[model samples]
Target: MNTLYRLGQFSIALTFPALAILLAVFGLPAVLLFLSSLNAPDFSLTNYEAFFSRGANVRVLLQTVEVSVIATLMCVIVGYPTAYIFAAASKGLRMALLVLVVIPYLTSFLVRTYAWIVILGDGGLINTLLLELGLISSPIPLIYNRMAVYIGMVHIMLPIMVLPLVSVMVGIDKSLSAAARSMGARPFAAFCRVFFPLSLPGVLSGSLLVFVLCLGFYITPAALGGLGDAMLSTFIAAQVESSFDLARIAASSFVLLGLAAVVLGIFGLDLSGAQDSRPHPAWKSPPDWLRSFGAPTRRVKELAARHRAKRWASTLYQAAGRGHLWKVVGTAFVALVMFYLLFPSVVVIIMSFSAGPSLHFPPRALSLQWYRSFFNNPSWTDAAWISIQIGLAVAVLSTIVGTLAAYGLSRTFPRLRSTLTMTILTPITIPSIVVGIAAYLGLLKVGLIGTKTGIILTHSIGATAYVVVIVSATLANFDRRLELAAKSMRASPLRAFTRVTLPLVRPGIIAGALFAFLHSFDEVVQTSLVSGFSVRTLPLKMWENIRHEIDPTIAAVASMLVLLPVAWLIVFYFTLWRSRPTVSGVPLETAS
Candidate 1:
């Protein structure tokens, strides 16, 4: 009876908060999506039918898949070599390489996509340099094309591919190649026969991740692709913002969601098999025959082996010894990517300071004319303010709800755990434009459309899944026994959570919050649908400006955005470093 009472108390403590978060952020929003798709004067499949009937929608869906597949393929091709190099390199070199990869990820995706515009556009750096070098008399048609979209998307998504590949690669036995060589296999042949097959899981997993992410991409394609190069996300946005057809948008979203699920399911199955099939390589001694040669033959063999080992070791040592040089080179590479990512935004910033009425890069002279103009314009300022407010609200709410969901789902449970995980991650799989349209249609009856609250709620919903994933990762590595100990000391669950669990996981929670804030701050499609004339966000304002002016002030805004997050990351890293012991602490228990 006493044990039952304790169990009841635990259930009460855990269930309500988890349920509240799940229903509000995950369950309710999904239910609303279904209702919105079905709600009409009469129940019908007309939305789905209209979706198929529209040739443009079909084209957009196909284009989205094409871009995603191409980008993911490019990521794998590029990322595999990069990850292999990192895994084989010495520790210092690996860390430096990792830092280089992470820089692009830390920066804004919009900014990076914008940077490609500056590089690929007519009269831009790439064209100007090529022309100066007499490579071509005319600028190439690079920007506003399918190729540009692929390049931009790949640049932003490459780190995602590389990180996962690196994780898997680190687990590979370094002596597998040596073992194969001892069996008389050549170096290249050994790699082909052994190493490549072992790394297939990482390749598939990374490719799937990049592809799914690319499916929902809007900023890169919208900024880089031509009219005919539109992807599903861009098309859906156009539907909501221009056509305002809620039903068609919902149907298109459903198609995107269904396709993403199929792709992910296939990849998930493959990953499961791959995980189970991993072979543990065992080391073996050199053959006795080889060890028992005549003194002269043994001496020759010894000399040859030493020579070969020295040659291989020298090659690797030389590469590793140049770690400092590689750091500099990696830093330069990262800086170049950053410059490319930030160039358009930097141009916009420069233009914002233009003395003239029109937008210009390398402003004739510097003035805060656009800045004054922007502030003076009520529409732009109002939108900017609304976006800031919505972003902050969404960031806080999503972080809190997502952290709780992460905690609940991270606990041991039945098969329902995987189902719940899928539910939490579903928002990311669904196209944002679809989410936007669904929210618009569903909320119309609830009077959420054309309201600031509606926009905040929508952004929060979209940001929650990302937060959950990030926070869940942090929780996965956390020590739960600390909480148990606190509970044993007579601390209530809330107190134990507040005093123990919160501090330990604060870094991840903050990281999740920062990501959520940036996501909401940069969101365009969903915000466009829910936001009325009265509630305009910064990205919406930027979208409007890009459509009309093609000015440098946008660049300026983007540069500022890039700097703020980079600055936050710096502080975050410092805080993380300071919190850790200089000496290695005791390791936590791992799952069996």
Candidate 2:
């Protein structure tokens, strides 16, 4: 009974700080959004009605769904093979491939999106090279079109699809294929019958993740697709910033939110059915003679355990071993995907050094003139500063809020936990542009427009969901006993958390914070609406510059932005690595 009381006290202590943060940040803002949607003039569904009435708005919403679905499909098609190859490769090769995939993810999304602009634009590398090679007589209309939007979005979203698939694929048993092969099946047939079926979970998980993320994407599509291929995000931004129609904005947000919820629910149901349908193999105990031989003596039991461990280790080593031909093919495939991921960003970084006024991939002469010009521009510097300020604030605030939300949900009842987690993750499902519009409408009465505080608050609100999900994943792995120990020592809940829980969960907090910072830093749609002429973020500045004209200066700015997060990721990886145990066999707790 005393033990139970101590455990309860510790859980409450560890959970309350996180809960407080969530209530203040996510809970309040979400409630405000729901209220604003229903509270215009008189309680009515006018906003929702307005959303459906506009043909262009409805078209944009459909387009957003279509593009996201298509892009997610492409990501899965490409990502599945790449993930399979990675899983089949040597450990060194796999780690290298993983790093290559992750590096692009660490870079700013806006910068990477802008990089596609230079590649797909008129007189850009793709067209210029094609024309020079006589592959085409004229430049193709790749930029400001659906093709461009799909290309840019798929490029950005591919890694998101690949990582999750890889996570699941690595756990699959290689012997499954061998066992099928021994049963008279060909290698391809064996894989299809054995490996592919097992990989379905990863495929589905990656697909859902990519699809959800793509639904809310604004920067890449806006930059690459322009007016011809405007998505729901762009439409929402236009409604909020250009038209200033609060009712329309609120209605559109509600509809987008509803669509996201429906899609997620369908995906969840399918996943649940898949899990349920899988046959559970019965567990078998070790032979009675073996247990009897081991005896009740510690020495005999220890010897038997060591022998069993050695056998398992040998099996794992043999399983990881693959043919040379398979290794080469896997390496090449991983290299190609990594190239596809990094190619555009490399082009932009190289162009940043061009002495020319316009974007030139392989400059006739390389110089730092563009970098000089970018630094000299006060607007660029100011925007950079503003983006940094907002990003840091959002990161800190979101981390605090997300940690709390994660704790609260973790301690709550299991059935309610899923529902709460879904609510917290809803911001990611709802397009950022819709969130921007909703916030713009809700804050109008409170006079939050064009202020730094308003933009930070808005960015933080969207960012909190990401932090909550990530931190919650980390908290899931945490041992309840550590907190109980602290409580048993007669420590106050707050003191126990600060001294015991905080140190252990710090990594997750940092990871969540890093993601939150990047979320705000890369965001353009929301920033565009909430920010006045007085507060232009780096992404907004880049958007304006691209709208007006394309120059090497923008490329220079992008290169720097790309490097900042990459550096941070490197530092973060090393910190995590240092904290982990040196022994490879150590049981590491997973965040989720």
Per-model TM against the reference: 0.78, 0.81
lDDT of each: 0.70, 0.74
RMSD of each candidate?
7.2, 10.3
Tens-place lDDT per residue, model 1, 199-285, is 887887788878888898887888888888888877776766677655666666778877888988776723211145565343356
Q: Give lDDT: candidate 1, residue 483.
A: 77
Total clashes, candidate 1? Answer: 8
Mind giving the per-residue lDDT tens digits that candidate 2 earns over 1-592?
Answer: 5564476544445345544444443455556667677774478876777778879887888888999899999898889999888887788988888888887887877777778778888889899999989999999988998888888888888888888789778888888888866554557878776788777777877788788778777777777876767776667666655786555666666677678778777867232112333522323568988778655697886787678666655564365355677768866877788888999889988988887666676888889998888789898888888889999998987787678767766787666666666655655655666666656655565687888888887877667777776777667777768677777888766666676667667777888888899889988877777776668898888888777775558888888887877777776776565675221234345422
For candidate 2, what is the lDDT? 0.74
* Candidate 2: residue 501 lDDT (0-100): 68
C-alpha positional error of residue 388 in candidate 1 after TM-score superposition, expressed in Å: 2.7
Q: Which sections of candidate 1 miss by over 4 Å?
A: 1-57, 130-138, 175-178, 181-184, 269-382, 581-592
